[model samples]
Target chain A: MIRSIRSQAQFYYGGLVVALVSLILVGFNYYERFGRLKTLDERLDEQLTIARPLMFRGPEERPPPRREERGEDLRRPEKRKPPPPDRFDPLPKLRKEIEVARFREGPQGEEVLASLIRDGFYVLGFKPNGEELFRSENAPDAVVPWVNKRDRAKKRDRDSFQRWSGDFREAIQFGQGRGYLLVGTDASRLHEGLNELMLKLSLVCFALTGVVLAIGWILMGKALRPIDQITKVAQSICEGDSNRRIDTDSIRNELGPLGRILNTTFDRLVRSVQQQIRITADASHELRTPVSVILADCDLALRKESSSERKQETIELCRDTALHMKSLIESLTQMARWDSSSDVLKKEKCDLGQIAEQTAKMFTPLAEEKNVEIIIETTPCETFCDPLAIKQTLANLISNAIHYNKPSGKVTIRTKRIGKSNIIEVEDTGFGISSQDLPKIFERFYRIDKAREIEEGHSGLGLSISKAIVEAHGGSIEAYSQKGIGSRFVIQLP
Target chain B: MKILIVEDNQRLRRSMLEYARAEGCVADAASDGEEGLYKALNWDYDLILLDVMMPKIDGWEMLRRIRERKTTPVIMVTARAQIDDRVRGLDEGADDYLVKPFEMRELMARIRANTRRVENNPQPCLEAGDIMVNTVKRLAYFKDQAVELTAREYNLLEMFMYKRNEVLSREFIYDHLFDERDETVSNMLEVYVYKLRSKFGKDSIQTRRGLGYVFMPES
Candidate 1:
C-alpha cells in the first residue's frame, strides 16, 4: 500500500526475510528431530537383540564380577551389590531378574517377567532355524515371520529398518545372522524434543527477521534520498524560483541518469518559455511603430495653420500606414496559426516545376518594378506535397530574393529530383547576406536591414512562416550566401 | 531647441521629426544609428533624442560615442520601458529617458526641459540684459513689454541669449536657425540678426569685427 519507493522496497525485503528465516528454522527442526529419533531407534535395536537373549538364558555363573579387586570371592560374606544400571549392559540385570522369577519354569513366571519389562515397547526375536526365541505379550505375533519373508524376498540376510507414523508411531528393525529383532519405540519422546526445538527456532527467527527489516529500511532510505532533493528543487521552481535545478552531481546511483535527464529537460523548457516571452515583447514593440506613425500623421493634420494640401497628404499617409499595419497583423496571425500546432498543412500530389513557374509569374510585376529578372528552370519534377503551402513558401523565397537583390539582378527558381528527393532552389544575384547574418535569416523578426524592411511593410515573419510550412511537409530549408555574390535558399522534400 | 532624432523605424522617425518641427523647434532626423551618431557629433544641437534599438549602432553606442567627443544632452527613446533599461540609460550618461509610442506633447515638454539646461537655467524664459525670450511660447519680452518678431528673428535672439557672452559664427547661427530641410540664402542669417538688433537697439548686438556677433549689452 505504500507508494514511496523506499518504503515499498523495505516492506518487500522485510517479508522475504521473515519467510526465508522461518522456512530455514522449520527445516532444521525437522532434520534434527528425524536424526535424533533414528539414532535412538538403532541403539535400542542393538540393546534389545543382545539383552533379550541374556534374559531368556536366566543366569551365567562363569562371568566374574567386574568390581572384584581381591582374589578371594566370598559370595555370602559381603552384601550383594545392587544390579548395575541397565543401559551399558542390561543383560546381567535382566538375567538375574528372570532367574529369580524362574521365567523358564512355567507360564506364570513368563507373565511376571513380561510385565516387569513392558516399559512402553514391544519386542520379538527369532533364531536362524526359524524358531521364535522370545516374544513379549504385546509383541506383534507375525513380526519374526514377516521379517523372514521380507529377507527372503529381498534375497539378502542383513539388518533392515522401517518406521511407521500416526497412532502407531514407532520403528521396526530386523537382525543379524543369529536372529531377528522387532522393536516399537513409543515415539512420543522424539515428538516432544521436536516441539521444543521449533519453539526455540521461532524465537531466534523472529529476532533475525526484525534485524533484517531494519537494515533494509535504512539501505532503501539511503538509495532514495536523492529523490527528495529533486522534489524540493522542483517545488521551488513551481513556486517561481524558475532557475532552480537539481544537483545531479551528488547523485551516484540509478537515479543519477534520471536526475540528469530531468535537469536537461527543465533547462530546455525554461529557455523556450523565455524565448516565447521575448518574442511577444518584440512583436508588441514592432506594432508600436505603425501606431506611432498613424498618431503622428493625425497630429500633423490637426494643426490649424496647416493647409488643405497638407491635411490631404496626411490622410493618404494614414491610410497607407493603416494598410501596412493590417498586413503586419495578417503576417503575425499566419505565424501564430502556425505556432499553435494544428493548422499545419494539407498534402496532395503537385508538380514542383509548374508551381515554381506559377509563383514566378505571380512575382513578375514586383520583379519588373525592381528590375530583377525571374528565371525558372525545371526538370518536370513531380512530388507529393501540399500545393498551396508549397506555393506560399516559394512566394516568400522569391519575394525575399527580389527585395534583397540589386537592380537588374537575376532570381533563378529551379526544381529537380535527386534520388527520391525533390530539391527546390531559389538563388538570387542580390546583395547577399553577410556571413554573420546567414544563420539567423529564418528567425522570426530578425532582419539584416531592419530599417528598410520595416518601412517596406515587411513584418519579418515571412521566412519563419516559410520554414514552418516546408518542414510541415517533411522537408528542410537551408541557406547559403556569400556576401558580395548572392544568396541561395534550398528546400529539400521527401 | 534643435534636437536630433536617431531612430531606426522610419515612420516613427518621420512622425517625431514632423511633430518637433511643427512645435517650432528645429529638428533633424536620422534613420539609423550610424547616421545619427555622425550628425550628432558634427552638429551643435541643444538636445539629442535617441531611440535605443537601431540597426547599425544602437542608442547606447551612439550615446557613448557622443560623450567621448562632447557633453551633449541625450534623451534615450525606446519601446523598452523597463526600469533596468531606464537606469542603464541614465547611468550611461543619458540626460533623460522616453518610452516609444509616447505622446508628442510629453516628448516636447521633456525636450524643452533639457534645452533649458543648455541655457544654464531651469525655467521656461531665458534672459540676457533687458531682453527675455519664453522658449515655450516662442515669445519675446523687452523690459516686460512684448516685442513682435518673425520666427527666425526670435530663434536667432534666443540663441544669442543662451550663448550670451560668447561670439557666434555666421555658419553656427544659420545651422541652428534652420534644419537640414531648410534652403537658405547666404544673407538670410544676417537679415534675421539685423532685424533683431533694430528692435533691441544697436548697442545690444555687437558685431565682433568680421568674426561674428555678440549679445553683450552694457550691464
Candidate 2:
C-alpha cells in the first residue's frame, strides 16, 4: 500500500513524540529512585552514629551489686532498685546524674556493654583479639556471621562503616584496633516502592503514545482533505472532461493556490477544445465553395459538345477553381499551425514604421487600379516581434483597406508609439461595416460582401489569420467601423 | 426568351451566359446583386437566374425586392445545396432552384421549363404552320421532314417560330442573338436571316420596307 503524505507525517511525528515522552519518563523514574536511595542512606548514617559510642566502651568499670542489696523479691523488679542498676551502668539512662565517684571502671566492659545492648538497636561489638564481645537481640542472622567474618579478615579502617546487605540494609563500623560494630535495617520496602513506580511509569508511557498517535491521525486527515479533493478533480480532468475544475472555495490552507492553478489549466483546456471545433467547421465551409465551383465547371464542360476553344475555357475555369481550393487549404493549414503551436513566433527587434512602409508600397499598384490612394506616415517606432508574422498582418490589413474602399478613396498606414506599446494603424475611406456585422468581421468564412469577396478570389480567411498571427506575437488587433464612412484597424505590440 | 443571370462567380456567370445563348435564349448577366436587381427591375425578362450569395445585395434580398412588384419567374442558382437554404429560396419566391456544380444541361432544361411555364405553353414543341420546332431537341421539321441546322440557325428559327406573325426588328434580333461582350458586325442579322430564308423558303418571310421581317406562314 502506498502511504499518503498524511500517514507518513503521522508516523514520524508520533514516533518523535512517543520517544520523547518515554525518555522523560525514564529520566523522572531514575531521579525519584536516586533521591529515595540517598535519603535512606542518610538515615542509616545517623542511626550508625548514635550507636557507635555505645559499642566501643569497655565493660569492667562497674560491677553488679550483691543479691541482698536488691532487698526485695525479684518479682518486684520495677519497684525495687532502679538506683542499684544505675550504679552499675556506665552509659546509663540518667547519664547526666551519674557523678564520676559513683561510676567505676571495669577490666572488661561486659556489664556496661550489656546494659547498652538493652536499648532497642540491633548492634554487635567485636574485641581486638577477634573474639565476639556483645550482640543485641533482634539483629538479623546474617549480621553476626558477617561481623565475625569481618573481624577475621582483619582489614579494618577506623571511623567508617563497612556496609553489607543480604535482603536487608546493614552497615558494620570498625573502631581503631577494636572489633566491628554492625548496624542493619530492612531495605525491601524501598525496593518494593521503586518497582511499583516503574510499573506505573510504563503504563503511562504506553497510554501517552496511544493518545498521541490517535490525535496525530485525526489532525493529519483533516489537513489533507483539501489535497485529496484536488487530486480527484485533477484525475477527472485528465480523463478528458476538460470542463472539470477544482472548487477553489472549498479548498483551504496552502492547497488553495494549487486548486486555482488547476482551474486555470482547465479553462485553457476548454478554450482549446472549442477553438478546434470552430476551426474544423470553418475549414469545411471554406473548402466547400471552391470544390463546388470546380465540380460545376467540369460537369458543365463534360455535358456540352462545344468547340475546342470553349472546352479549353471550361478546363481553365476548373484549373482556376483548383488553385483557389489550394490557396484555401494552405490558409487553413497555416491557421492550424498557429493554433497548435502558439509559440512559433521568433521575436526580433524590428521597426514597425519600416514594416508599415513596405506593406503600403506593396499595395500601391492594387490601390491605383481601384483609383484609391495609399498613404504612409511613420514615426520610426521600434519594437521586438516576429517580423514575418507582423509583415503578413500588415499586408492583410492594407489589402483589405484597398479592397473595401470606394473609388478615389484614401488608405492610410501609420505607425507610432503610444505609452509602452508600438501601434500600427490602417485607416481606410472604404465602405465600412455596419454595427451588426462589425463584431463578426474577424471570423473565418465571414464575408460582408460575399459577391465582391468571391470575385476577388478571397477565401474570407485573411482577417482571421491576421488576428491569430497578431495574438501569437503578444499583440492585439481591433477594428472600428461605421457604415458608409470607413474602417480603421489598429494593432498594438509590446 | 430573355433572361437575367445574377451570379457572383465570374467564370460561372460567363459559362451560364454562354449556355443560355446556345439554348436559343437571350441572356444578360451582372456580377453582383445590386447590379442584377437594377437590371432585373428595369427589364421584362421571361426568367431570372439568381445566385444566393452575392455582394452589395444578396440574391435573397434581391428576390424579395423583385417579388414585391414583379412576378417574373426566378431560378435560384447557388453553391449552398443545404435543405434549409433550398426551402428558404423556394419560400422566398423562387420558381426553381439549381445547385452549383450543376450540369449546364440541367440549367438549360430548367430555363426552358420556366420560360415555357411563363408563356403558358406546356408542350416542348413550337409550331408555326408547317414548321414545327422541338425546343428540347433543337430540331426543326418542315411538313414531317427534319432539317439539320447550325445552333445559331436553329436559335433564329426557334425565335421566329415563337413569335410567328410579329415583326421582329433587325435591331431586336441582334440584341437577342448576341451577348453584351460579342462584337457584332451590322450584317450579321442579315446573314442569319438570309440563311433562314434559303432553308424555309423566301415566301415564308416578309420584310416591310423600312420595317423588319415577319414570319408569314399563310403567304
In terms of TM-score, the best-performing candidate is 1
Tens digits of per-residue lDDT for model 2 on A1-494?
43788778877777788788888878988898778777766766666665655554443422234455636465655543345333565566335223321321332333434443453336666665656655556666655434455644644333444454666656666664545666666777887898898888788788878887898789878878988788888888789877777888976788889889878878877778887887776776666666666665665566556777867977877777777777788888888778866678888888889988987898878988999999889889878888888888898899899988999999998999999999999999999999999999888778877656665678888898999998887889999999999999999888
lDDT of 2 by residue, B52-158 (tens): 87877889899999999899999998877778999999998999988765777788888888867876667899887778889898899888899888877887787
Q: Global CA lDDT of candidate 2, please?
A: 0.77
List each candidate's DockQ score: 0.39, 0.24
lDDT of 1 by residue, A76-190 (tens): 5776566574477778655654673364346754554364356566655555555776666675444434544544555343335555534333344343244454555556777
Q: Can you give the lDDT of residue B126 in candidate 1?
A: 81
* Residue A429 accuracy (lDDT) in model 1: 96
Top-scoring candidate (lDDT): 1
> Candidate 1, after superposition: displacement of residue B139 in Å?
4.1
Per candidate, the number of residue pairs that clash is 0, 13
Instruction: Please tell me which predicted candidate would have the highest DockQ against the true structure.
Output: 1
Against the correct fold, how does model 1 do in TM-score? 0.64
